[model samples]
Target: MKSSRIQSFAAGVLIANSAPHLATAVTGRQHLTPLAGRGSGPKVNAVWAALNLVGGTLLLRASRRGGTERWDGDLIAFETGCLAFASWMAGSERWLRTNTARQE
Candidate 1:
């Protein structure tokens, strides 16, 4: 049990550290762009929005299965993060659309 707890702790730490890279990868893939290449902001934002929705769903499911009473904080954080990402994506898309309209 102790070893398992330690492993779980390590896993969490690793996940936290790797989140930025994962986010970038997901953003890139959603935009259909190379990881090292520049992608349209709107496209990336849309991808992020989609990913956040999906991630939020998954997190909620996990929370439910794990018993939310025990991990309420994590669940709340996940939900908040998803909302933040989605909102940012929406803003990005709106900005891009407006910019394009201006150019036209």
Candidate 2:
């Protein structure tokens, strides 16, 4: 794929990755992210989320047609896959922490 396509795909993944952090930040809840370590703080998550959103938007805008037009299936799938993988990893890490804490 071309660089524009790759950027578009990355933008999708970044936005997907930002969702939970953004939601938690807006709702004044804590979330686990790499920056947050385990449970840093709502504000921290918010900052991280905002950064993600900015980066994603920038990438999308740099893509073909400035990401305003509709995207193709392959690109969407690639983005979705990235999102799913990242989300799963985050959730799995949280789950492991919870289980470990429970056992302790």
Candidate 3:
């Protein structure tokens, strides 16, 4: 049960991480994704998004294995927590760098 819950939570994190990058890629925008290096562009972002989708799908499948068929509160909480942290970090990195650059 505990292992299943952990896998489910991990799946949630990957799914959440995938969504924004996919959206940005589909929209043909160059947004800051995890894989986007300093020279990020539309094509790079799109590739990054594809990787996220693949990873998320794999984790989702893994979560479904080992007799885990339903969602649990702990699973949900862990997923949500990871998603929120990822979002915050992604959103803040650029702003932080820009602000610090100006201050220098």
Q: Which candidate is the best by TM-score?
A: 2
Q: Give the Å shift of residue 88 in candidate 2.
A: 3.1
Backbone clash pairs for candidate 2 read: none
Model 1 segments more than 4 A misplaced? 1-69, 97-104
Better of 1 and 3 by lDDT: 3
For each candidate, what is the lDDT? 0.44, 0.71, 0.63
Count of clashes, each model: 0, 0, 0
Using lDDT as the measure, which candidate wins?
A: 2
How well is each residue in 1-104 modelled by candidate 2, as lDDT tens digits?
Answer: 46776776788777776777788788877667778575757898888888888988897777755344567753675577477757775787677653133454
- Ranking by lDDT, best first? 2, 3, 1
- Cα lDDT of candidate 3 equals 0.63
TM, every model: 0.35, 0.67, 0.64
Q: Which is better, 2 or 3, measured by lDDT?
A: 2
lDDT of 3 by residue, 1-104 (tens): 66656665676676666665667667765566556555456677677767766776676566667553565564674577467757776677666762122454
